[model samples]
Target chain A: MSDTGQHSHDHTPRPDQDGPPSYYQAMETAVRELLIEKGVVTAEEVRAAVEAMDARSPAQGARVVARAWSDPKFKARLLKDGSAACAELGIDMGPTHLVVVANGDKLHNVIVCTLCSCYPRFLIGLPPDWYKARAYRSRVVREPRAVLGEFGTEIPDDWEVRVHDSTADMRYMVLPRRPEGTEGWSEEQLAGLVTRDCMIGVTLPKSP
Target chain B: MTARFGPGDRVRVRWAHPPGHIRTPYYVRGKTGVIERICGSFRDPEELAYARDGQPERPLYRVHFDRRTLWPDDQGRAKDGVEVEIFEPWLEPADAAMEGGT
Candidate 1:
């Protein structure tokens, strides 16, 4: 047995965890604790809500996209009412409305929340860090093509690049056009090609 | 609730900026665009932000602004456009909206 207690290692704290919680973080903690103390919500309920949010992933949105590609009826419903269509597939979008925009050979759609980082969290889980950054929020609306180029996506010269600003009550998700050579493919097979970036309209799905 | 502006109706975003939880982007203010579709009525986010019940929901519309109208620079292609969700209160008929006036 080695004498492990003889020496102490001065370990550096994680850079992100070194400082105190941010203003919003502290406010959230205070409010949550007060709510729990007042019996408004239980700790278990809070934990369960967090777990539910974490459980949601890009896979859910991919499934919806795959289904839409396989079924025209679902695609129409998705375009008309994204929230209800998603609910038909058991993905509850909560209160925020979802707006699904389609991409085609002549038109490409990209989504950004200019006011804040509003996203289709229920369908595609939490948004990526870049989506929340001010650079993306401002630049995507001003110069979308350049922003897309930074993501390694190039918009054709003649093609139209439409940007959806998810301001106010609505959230947006881009329904990327199915890639070529995917004919007769099953929904499961198609789902694999639908990436989070594709749904966000930053990049296209890779062909298998 | 009935929508004031229907699809294809040209509308302009009100330029006035009140200090509150406003959802309209600054860039679109005073800019003219065609109403793409009615996005249904929803609670007023301006009031809802203050924990108040936004009584009598307001109609929302998806307004499509051409990139050229919004930005004069050569940023986007000619067909490029940007659509924003604007509450009914922030929009007025394009014909009725004039420079230096409401």
Candidate 2:
């Protein structure tokens, strides 16, 4: 699928933009300018980095998930060393140790960073706005079932819900269970069913 | 450096509230849990945040805590567990206190 994720939507000033730039935003700009001034990093390199980050989307993670669903060996490798498994797919997770958790019949896993909004940005791109919000960062760990419920994901009482707190150097991604009735489907077709939210452990991939 | 804790070993998080850029969450402070896995160590985040080279890296473990134990309420199920990445400095052998007495 060659579709760029940039969809046309009504552009408007965000609610948070009612005031001046945040202190952290100003600090980032100041540091970036100083780095460019000192020739530490070129302006072109900065632009390229941002370009690469934006170019990344959930499709990369979807491909990895689809491959894992199709290949058991690859899945095992993925569960063992998430960073290495992702590298095999040519997805570079720079300076981050990845931990991929698989969702099974009796187990469900969710990812959160109670300290901050730490996410596998290299594979899935930047996190959603809500993921960075204080409410999500705080409440998800305290009341995961209720938070999952808010996302319309209902975990059965008998099932085990595992919440992964990405509090350190390790980043996490959920390997969602494949939908049923999709036998004989190609990896490309299977990838189409995996959504961003599915990889985030907020919801499950629906059968098509 | 060799890891102090291994998988399935019961350990308790350090209860001290020293100020710094800490990765250990406030909720898991002083809680007891079993080590799930040894996620090879890296530079101390507390020092790294202050732009210092956190030399002599410490071992980091993925401690698995029961969700109900962290939050004792009817909202969470018994099977639910929360795994947090904690450095060696913030953890101690839970059985350390029970030993050398009996």
How large is the interface RMSD of candidate 2?
A: 0.6
TM-score per candidate: 0.93, 0.91
Encode model 1's per-residue lDDT on A21-132: one tens digit a residue: 8999999999999999999999999999999999999999999999999999999999999999999999989986888999987999999998889999988999999999
Off by over 4 Å in 1: A1-16, B100-102
The candidate 1 chain A region of ten consecutive residues with least summed lDDT is A9-18
Clashing pairs in 2: none
lDDT of candidate 2 over A1-208, digit per residue (tens) = 4557977666886677467779999999999999999999999999999999999999999999999999999999999999999999999999889999999989999998888899999989999998889998888788888999999999999999898999998999999998998899999999999998889898899677
Task: Please write out the lDDT profile of model 2 over residues B1-102, one tens digit for every residue.
Answer: 999889999998887788988899888887888999999989999999999999879899999999876776647788999999999999999877343211
How much does each candidate deviate from the true structure in C-alpha RMSD?
Answer: 5.3, 6.0
Query: What is the TM-score (0 to 1) of candidate 1?
Result: 0.93
After superposition, the stretches of candidate 2 with alpha carbons farther than 4 Å from their true spots are A1-20, B98-102
Instruction: Quote the true-contact fraction of every model.
Output: 0.96, 0.93
Error of 2 at A109 (Å): 0.1
Candidate lDDT (C-alpha), each: 0.92, 0.90
Model 2 CA lDDT for position A21: 73
